[model samples]
Target: MEAGDIATWVGVLITLGISVATYVQSRRQARIADEANIASQEQVEAAQRRAVAVEDSLAEALRLLAERGLTEAPPTPAMSGGPGAVRWNLERRGKHSYLLRNVGTATATGVHVDRNRATPIVRNMPENATVRPGESLQFLMAPTFGNPLPGEVWVVWEGQPEAISVPLP
Candidate 1:
């Protein structure tokens, strides 16, 4: 071929090679970005699992502590206005009363107790009682209180941000 024709052909070949290389490079970059996104999602899921594990551990610790004993003295019935400051230990059996105890370090205020069922019946126990750290409160409920159907006590403590459902024996 003539020199001009050869040069034109060479230029066209070079431009086509550069375009193909650029496309390949872009595809490689997109794959890397997708891999990074998948890695980030996996990390987030792992973190969520860890958080759930931590919450479970804390709950178990609290249950163990409550089972052991109360660390502080509880307020009197008159001062407490009656039962409701703490949750009952379903493991404990009593002829006339359920064994209630406080497991938290701080006093639980505005305690509300409810018997769980299809239709929950809130106990008429004192709503503003305070249960001291590690203290037990004998809850004398009426109508011959029986074992909980679900084996759990729903308790709301004052000064606490949220309510806790404690498992019974």
Candidate 2:
């Protein structure tokens, strides 16, 4: 070939080599993007499966609670009084709130907290409150101008006739 023709051929070869390199690089990048997309899809599917499992577990727990509530019977008046008398306890729920719980096997009706001797005066005491076994009544107790909060208080309920001393925990 002539000298000018040889130079032109070299330039054409260089251009062809660059085009092939760009095509190969672009194909490699496309393969990497496809792999990344597939991995992302798999992660999303796994997350969806986990969410479904959690939802199913919560539904099963709610179903069991509903079934238990349906099967249980109410306590009779005869079950209370005498040996299975209504027991009471006081718990400090927060800085100003207290929970009066019936820890006995029987239900306590017309429950009242005697704030006469207590240091912190009990406020918002429900009038004629009824507390069933394992149930509690929450009330607010705050410090007055005179005395500090005590560790124990007197609790009274209907049919008991006497006020019982309940201690705080």
Candidate 3:
């Protein structure tokens, strides 16, 4: 063959090599992207499961507390009130959370609870309640009450203001 033919053959081989390398790189990138997507989805699912667990635990604890008489509902105006039977005025947006004291000199006897059938959540209990007479407790709540249903908390707390707190779950 002529020198030109040999040169053309070499150019063809180089072009083919480049094309194969490009294809391989593209395939590798696609695999990496898929793996990343799967991992991200798994992380989101795990977070959701954790949120459910927290809500369930809260519900169970509240139920147990009620049974054990740890939780005391507010009494009627005539029945009379005690130091431990007072409601911590809550400014809750959603999900049962501990109160940041509004304006009172009362101590936290125990955390409040919301037992809505659709959504049931409970405030964090004091490990060893150290709330001062006028100071607020330092507990935060979930962004929203993830119903064990959804929107059921509003009903239970509404009918009995003395028995239950305001709408939280």
Candidate 4:
């Protein structure tokens, strides 16, 4: 091959290398952008979930303040697990009590899990003790474990799906 021909071939190889490098860089940037979009979508979904939870809590608070006569006395200190998932919070308003009985015709309930997450309270509740839908035996309010919880407290109660907190305090 002639010297001029060799020089021309070298120039062509350099241009091809530059083109391949540019393509690789562009592909890498595209992948990075895609990953960023996915992360942003997940964050949005999490925010939406938190917003819903807050809305439900607000609705419950409203219900507590609106009702007057329905809730004569406070209910039992509802027990639950985990950090955020609380069935009831009577820490500030003092200890609470409950005497739940089935109103429905032989509907199964009281099947609860133990501390180790086992089904220990399988049908723990007694038979139909005749607590009507609008009737409760003795949803009393007692003191806490040791202390008389004073001051303005922030107690949160989360009931079942079909249940709403009555006589909001």
C-alpha RMSD by candidate, in order: 21.4, 23.9, 15.2, 21.1
lDDT of each: 0.55, 0.72, 0.46, 0.39
RMSD of 4: 21.1
Top candidate, metric lDDT:
2
Instruction: Give the lDDT of residue 24 in candidate 2.
Output: 100
* lDDT, candidate 2, 1-169, per-residue tens: 8999999999999999999999999999999968966775665456446645755775687677778886644335425456646877778889978888888887676777787766656555644666667877777677777777777778878777787888767
Off by over 4 Å in 3: 69-169
lDDT of 3 by residue, 48-157 (tens): 46645755775787687788887675433213434343334445544434444424343333233433332333333223232334444433344334434332222111
TM-score of each candidate?
0.40, 0.50, 0.39, 0.40
Could you tell me the TM-score of candidate 3?
0.39
The alpha-carbon lDDT assigned to residue 71 of candidate 3 equals: 63
Model 1: how far residue 97 lies from native, Å: 60
Ranking by lDDT: 2, 1, 3, 4
Tens digits of lDDT, candidate 1, 33-145: 68966775665456446645755775677677778895744443323534444433433445424546765444554565654331232222334444555655444343324
- The residue pairs found clashing in candidate 2 are none
